[model samples]
Target: MEVKDKIVIVTGAGSGIGRATAIHFAKFGATVVVSDINTESAQKVVDEIISNKGKAIVNKCNVAKFEEVENLVNSTVNEFGKLDVIVNNAGIGPNLLRTHESRLKDWDAVIAVNQTGVFYCMKVALQQFLEQGYGNIVNIASLAGLKASPNNISYSASKFAVVGMTKSAAMEYATKNIRVNAVCPGYTESALLNQLIGAKPEMDAILKSVIPMKRYGKAEEIADAVVWLASDNTRFITGQTITLDGGTSL
Candidate 1:
């Protein structure tokens, strides 16, 4: 759908891909709701959007909490009059740990945020879409969801679940005009990847070497793809994971 003047919601928009996606949507004339766990960060993004002559609002939400997600959707509709699109981009990655070394706490935390959080967002957004007869969802999954990441088993598992959720939800709502899709970014330059590289400095070179492009993907590049997918031009597309990795998976 055309994004101009559409009411959009972007979660985990305090930093990284979420932030970029929120700003990009606003730049395209969408009235964006900048939802993030951090209040200050969310407000900052809202301020940035307003400074650039774009429309935005801040909503502090911890996606792991179902109640908070429900409130987010309710409040968005209350303030904007309707909901058009939602980007379930809020996710967390546990530190790199092998499957055997992984702790239950770490695994649960990752799943709660990355997988279950997306489910909650999708569920609430779909409800509103059903009420309004249309909506769009772009979930930020990961390249790890497609291929095994040896050191980060928890994150991979959770993302894989997100990919599945996206497909299942899309199929169920395809005839209802509610489109659900996913964006799988590989080793993009973001706080998450920087943290991973910080822990294993040697892996930085290894990561770049594996990518045929020999470079890390940019947050804006991924953001561009997200906004495009959220547009009306892709009404025929749903339940697909658009991988943004630089040929690393190949």
Candidate 2:
């Protein structure tokens, strides 16, 4: 699935790995649709991609809202004329607290963004893919999805759900010319991690130590895996998670 010249949509393109992945797709010769909760952030990303001479559009959308997600997909197809890939990267982590002690709001927020959001994006992407007879999905599940992340029960639960959803969908559509896969990044440097680190330094330190690499993964590194998964390189790959956790899962 050479992404070059393809129409791609990436949710949470405002910052972090999503931002990097958006730019990477553009660099690979794809026309990108940048969607985010913040209009300003989404526009900012669009501008940067344009400044780099890449084709892109900014679409402000809240993935948790079905209507917004629908609009995001419709607008992309309206502008680009076709859809080829969708990267569901928008997600929120849990507050650094035990489940019983954590605010219920935090729990709900994590589930809505990290899990439900994936569902919305996938639903829309799959519709277009089935109609066109081609598509690819690279879900950004977390290292937490496959292992325990103490004090972040809500976050872990949402990611784990994403993993399950990706596999189920992949199996359902393996013969539909739509390849679905996920990437489980280990302690990637991102806004969510920074926020959690601020709230609990010791917890962050423990996470880094568990990784065999003993450091946080970079956004571009994760983006690399995402690109491969969306390209012809991984044509036979589906219903699998390429876990790059520096041996954390081992």
Candidate 3:
């Protein structure tokens, strides 16, 4: 992965997979913008990167808002001189309920953050890329996006939209040198997973049992794939979804 000196942005970078990806990008010598809704957590990740002799900055952004997303990209370019890559990783899960039983508010919230958020980021970044003539975008989707997620209608719908957007944008911008791709992770070990397991302890085992590997994925493992996709190593690959599910999607 040759990402040295690349200007990269990782949304939802305060913790979990986004945090790991930000750290990894910094370690690879990329100037990373750790963007998150949580300013404190984003600052902590920035501090950790700086302490490790890596360049990083904190940008508090709620991806749900287009204006905020615009500012995030504009500010990064204003500070860094150019935009190179953006990892659209900020997303929210929906309440555990069937489609008919789910609240409309939950669906709207999930779509706002998970689907529309990605669109805003991509739109703003693509504008910059069109001007610069090159860019990379890696969207963090989910196994639910590829397969059906029963009782998780909102999450599934949003992630599926992410996958669709990635492919569509890739095709639309291929001639412009803008590459777009997605990573679909399954049951990754993260704060989100912890919350789910906390709510239903038995889910941990049940989730693992369906996978051939019979285990969860680490945040760092998913980060590695994201970085590779963002790096020059995968320059020729676009509009693709890399599944990191420990065989759950098999």
Candidate 4:
């Protein structure tokens, strides 16, 4: 997928799937805006991209905040003149607990960042896209969004919202040259997964055993799907969720 000269924005580009996706976009010749709440981590990614002769810039943003999300999209356009695509990769996972045992604070936290954050970013970006007459969005949802996530109610709910919003927006602007899609990664080797493994060491084996591939997916693997969905190669594909679960969901 050639995205040369395209201007792209990747939220939570400081780590994991977000980091990988930002790097991939830069490698493919997109002028990437590496956005993260952690400016330090974001700068490191920008430095690496610059060192490799790739184009990128750091834009600190807390996606949970509407003002920051607005500024993220606005600042990118202000700096780059236009935005071609946005990868809504910034999201937080929840503590593993049954619904009744789960903390309300945890649910709120997850919804704020994962669900509302995606909506905030999409809302601002859609405005810009409408003005420009064309744009693309690739939301990094989770396989949990597509199926039952037993103990992780909040995360599942937030991601499900992302999937719904993606589809709704895709159909709403289908004829307007705006494409919206989501990537649902299952048991990926991400910081979120590491946290889970840290809490329950046996989860690593348990998770892998359920997947047909019998392995945890690499962040780069998920990034590849994000890149493809954002590229012109999938120009006609929208309102879709590409699940990368190694058949675990089946």
Candidate 5:
């Protein structure tokens, strides 16, 4: 329950929510494994953690690749002897487009990272949890996964699959001491959202106008939810999706 001294792995730790979550864990005294597709970025996170007097290691990993995911898990165990929690946060948002006009390649790319990538991480973490008799997994889905987004079919569809996967995995591993859950963030302030708004500056105001809070969610706010879900306080909770969307879904 207490993340202090626990071995935690967070994918996509290079930036945004992933970076925030990694730092959050370290701040709680967890021994973190900072993994990202970019080795340089991962190392920078590692350095930051070290500078702050936290224990951490860096792993260059792309969760979309099954082999890379496997290596990430294997190396964690080899280095720390056990894994306590894993955050499946690596995902990509495709360009906005009507479903009928969407490119096959775009759809495939979104599914590969957002859907299949979560599966790969879950698969490996479940196996490790089974062996260890306990583990925690927090997946980052999206508000799009819960509600329909008119022009973003591929992104929404992939995230919807993630929400489904979270529930199914939680049911299967309930009695095994492996708790699974998802966090759906709505219009979070992150590099991913920045890129989207950069192309369509008007969306910056249009998107925020809908949220009841009248502002975008913060990465640290999402990280707080994720860390809590991973803690002992939520042990009895599983097979659930915690939506941090600033009341937009309402």
Candidate 6:
């Protein structure tokens, strides 16, 4: 369970689940690279980790952009010497209306951040892993990926792509000492959801009724699963997705 001295990168480490994961890994003694588009938000977590005597740094990056992602890995290795794990946790929800009704601008934003962003992070990380001889990858997909949320075409499609990428990449490098996997969460209680609920509580209730557990998920719970996947304890496991849905997919 000890990842002491291991350098791990967490995208979207500004808030919500990403922030939680960054803090959790730092507490576990990992040298954390906290990456986010907003330096202000990311620095807050880095400040907290440093205050507690954990190793961390804030990297202002937008994963969708290749230049930023490349710089992110390079800076981490420059500062920490090597990278052992990466959490492709940066993603955006569907901000569009419907698939057909989606504006080009909205669709482009979602695809770039959610789908392409995962590819960018993994591609760079895998190259580092090849040189280092071992690596661990944890991708954040969603229950929307499995359930086909028609109303949220952009999000569902991006998450589904994440699942596909994790499995395919895992197979390609399974013998090369790289472990790739995805974590699919249900309607977790997060800042994004709170905003959504505030805008449309009635619609939220309708969606909540679909969950058997009938409640929101906490960020810490998801952090636990992500940590386990990155640890040596799950070495034999790869190309698999662990769902955190409240039996909603069942």
Global lDDT of each candidate: 0.93, 0.90, 0.95, 0.95, 0.93, 0.90
The lDDT leader among the candidates is 3
lDDT of 4 at 250: 88
lDDT agreement of model 6 with the native: 0.90
For model 6, the run of ten residues with the poorest summed lDDT: 92-101
lDDT of 1 at 103: 91
Q: Put down candidate 5 lDDT per residue, 1-250, tens digits, no spaces.
A: 3689889999999999999999999998899999999889888989999999998999989888999999999999999999999999999986888989999999999999999999999999899999999999999999999998888998999999999999999999999999999999999999889988998999999998999999999999999999999988898999899999999999
Tens digit of per-residue lDDT, candidate 6, span 1-250: 6677789999999999999999999889898999999899999999999999999988889998899999999988888788999999998776637677888887789889999999999999999999989999999999877776876878888899999999999999999989999999988888778766777778688868998998878888899899989988888999999999888888
Q: Which runs in model 4 stand beyond 4 Å of their true positions?
A: none
Clashing pairs in 1: 1-231, 1-232
Which lDDT tens digits does candidate 2 get at residues 29-49? 989999888879888889999
Which stretches of candidate 2 lie above 4 Å from their native place? none
Model 3 misses residue 160 by how many Å?
A: 0.5
Worst 10 residues of 1 by lDDT: 91-100
**Model 2 superposed RMSD (Cα):** 1.3
| Model 4 C-alpha lDDT per residue in residues 8-88, reported as the tens digit of each score | 999999999999999999989999999999999999999999999999999999999999999999999999899999999
- Which should have the higher TM-score, number 3 or number 5? 3
Can you list the residue pairs that collide in candidate 4? Answer: none
TM-score of 3: 0.99
Task: Evaluate residue 123 in candidate 5 and report its C-alpha lDDT on the 0 to 100 scale.
Answer: 98
